[model samples]
Target: MNGTATHRTVIIVGSGPTGLLLAGDLATAGVPVTLLEKRSHDISNLSRAFGVHARTLEQLDARGLADQLLATGDTITGLRAFDRLTLDLTTLESRFPFMLITPQYEVERLLERRAREAGVDFAYESEVVGLRQDADGVELEVRGADGTVAVRRAAYVVGADGHHSAVRREIGLDFPGVSVIKSLFLADVRLAERPEDVLTVNGAGDCFAMIASFGDGWYRVMGWDRHHEVADDVPIDLDEVKDVARRALGSDYGMHDARWLSRFHSDERQAPRYRVGRVFLAGDAAHIHSPAGGQGMNTGLQDAANLSWKLAAAVQGWAPDGLLDTYETERHPVGKAVLRSSGGLVRLARAQSPALRAVRALVSAVGNTVGPARRKALGQISGIGYRYPALRGAHRLTGTRVPDVALAGGRLHEALRGGRFVLITPDPQAYEDPGTRKDRLTVECWASGRRTTVLVRPDGYVAWAADAPDATAIEEAVAAAVG
Candidate 1:
């Protein structure tokens, strides 16, 4: 079949953070996974995504990698937006209550390490040239660094590839959206003077810019000039960055001596479907949005987290009915919400006219004065407040994100490292029955006097919960959830 296809349980296209995280998760869960990357094994030092949100950190924490990443990155407890509004990340209920500012490469390094150690078959410099799927499985035509093309088969295929995904094209999925910002340029340069704030952002009528430290001697300066808009192909130099910063940020902290500079555009796009038969898409392949709130990479990583355990369950043959379809049902709306929120931020940034300014004022006023709205904004940006849809008559806590509460053994995330649904019960004695034990489920007892018994998915969302200590109900729900 298809010229002797080499089979794998899953073939993940792309080696970016999404692919790496998904590949590592599957491998950690003992699924045979092959990660096909067009790039070589050598790591790149350059990074476009500098800020990792709190929710992503939590996901990594569950994977046992967050502390290492946090140790190396700078933490900002608050986010400055519109030069007036600030989101207090410290108020978040999660353990990581701040944004970690580090390059995307750092994340890749950690994930790649975990994946390699977990036995992921990495095919570096192997690009997906063609793909096909049938009722049984999916097939792929991968081209290696050499001229040779090889046919591969997999139970499922995931496109964690970037925006211009060959897998998406192969599957005939359209990434439908437009560019939100044009002629955006950024550079890592040394500032001759320090800014008033650790993270400086401002915008005049014609330009907008932001400055943040990399903790190294260099700084990242991102700027956009409305009056001098040009195609992304135009070459950007240190002067363009400096000029925009001076106009908007009022000095760019006397920025100079750029180490890296580039011009590009940002888009707000999401695939109409994240899953097609045996093939799936996650991360940038499924959705992308403006970096206005630094949500692009964070959203992609979260997509991978939502999809990984489901894929594992499916591969292991214990997945519940329609479990695979839930990936799109849960993640697609979150992708749309990210696009809307990030697009709104971009539009608000460029708002100059009386009407636009009024809208901006209203948003800022609401963010400052309204506690609920402010919390929502923080939740959206930090990726914490999102919940999947639950069926009718489900528990009130069903589909909501479960906080990392203290268990008798350890933290909730620590218990999730095995990539299994964790049932937190105050009545551990009741769950001691052999019927409650499942290979794909972990049972933990509460450290504190908690009345609610909650079943948390591997990705940290509550699958089922009950206020009453009903052992029979929990056993039935666990059987339905994991088996």
Candidate 2:
């Protein structure tokens, strides 16, 4: 307990996808970030998540990382669920309209690389055992590999740890929710005869199974048995997994050579508050739910993206009042919605009663027949429907994610890689000189006949937009957003 205490700009606990992305973004913006992780530096081959949706791909594209990640994964233009409903991504309004199917480890690997390139200091083999925050900053008590305890102080602390987060516990936050399903088995193995579909999922009366290839020879299989209510530590037999798959999928596809296998229970839980003073919770530390729609890791990554810019603004001394608090106000609802949607999917898939199954079939038929309904459902699951609340009197485009527009320079997302707000105005003379706020804002003219002036946040959300030039409103909005 005698090790020296050190101070950092931000201390991020847990080096998962959320933590890594946040660290990379903050560090890229010149905020000093220290990442503390309990796991070793070695990357794991086994992965629980394998799909990245369109909105997430756009976020990655803003950082110039989508293509790199896309190269490692396969893509699916449509997804079928419940044996009747099909959600097509081809009609999505984005450069990447398909879901990228790759192991979660691939994502972590890319984010880790980005974080390292941004000069984020990683303290592996360090676990945060306690946290205390005052008016100015937070103090973390960390236990290192050799049993040495040290205090690390930071202006802010973010808990990106998994469900059992020490940081969340240290702050006395209650993770309130219940387990939705138990006795789910996860396995990665070789498929003797691969399915033609990019991802295949089905649920029978009492069981459900999903299989997706990693683009490699191995395929991931997840299934649940209604009768097997055993503890997580109980050994899983391949025969049992195949049995469940056969029951739910009607065939096991000659699965063999199990590389990894385990059992876990999915819970629908959310923290009462994402922020308690200067300590904030994100990713699984804030919310978790059933993996029915493959939304868990994608939701966490989006949370990191939403928070990184605000934290950077704070660290760099330009954040406006209440800007930091918006993190919880904006994201908590999204987290809760994800929990509900995923839970609903799980309940529908696990329904054993004949009447419930009939209801599922009816709903699927409606979803398939109704175009608007299918698009809405697809948007929700794919995250394209997410929109923040705009400021009162702001333009209608405010709070909406700006599409990747073609500009004179290049694509809209490509211009955002510099980590600065982009002001797109048809009238170049409508705004003040960029020289004054060059550190935080960039002025660009629309290449086409776009008469509207839009102020886009670093995260690609339209902060303020106007049909015509409003110099005074632009100045005031800029001040309120950046300072």
lDDT of each: 0.88, 0.88
Q: Model 1, 1-483: lDDT tens per residue?
A: 223233438889999999999999998998888899998887775678889998999999999999999876688899877857889888999899989988788899999999999988888889899999998799899888887899889999999889999999999999999999877887888988977655777888878898877777678888888888788778888877887888886785777788788888888889999999999999989988888899988998998999999998888788889999999999999999999999999999898789988889889989988999999999999999899999999989999998889999999999999988898999777675465345677889999998889989999999999899577888798888977
In model 1, the worst 10-residue window by lDDT is 1-10
- Residue 278's lDDT within candidate 2 is 90
Worst 10 residues of 2 by lDDT: 1-10
State the lDDT of candidate 2 residue by residue for 382-466, as single tens digits. 8888889876776789888888987767788988998899988887788885475787887787889888888899988988887
In the order shown, the candidates' Cα RMSDs to the true structure are 2.1, 2.1
Off by over 4 Å in 2: 1-8
Count of clashing pairs, candidate 2: 0
Q: Report the CA-based lDDT of candidate 1 relative to the real structure.
A: 0.88
| Displacement of the residue 269 alpha carbon in candidate 2, Å | 0.2
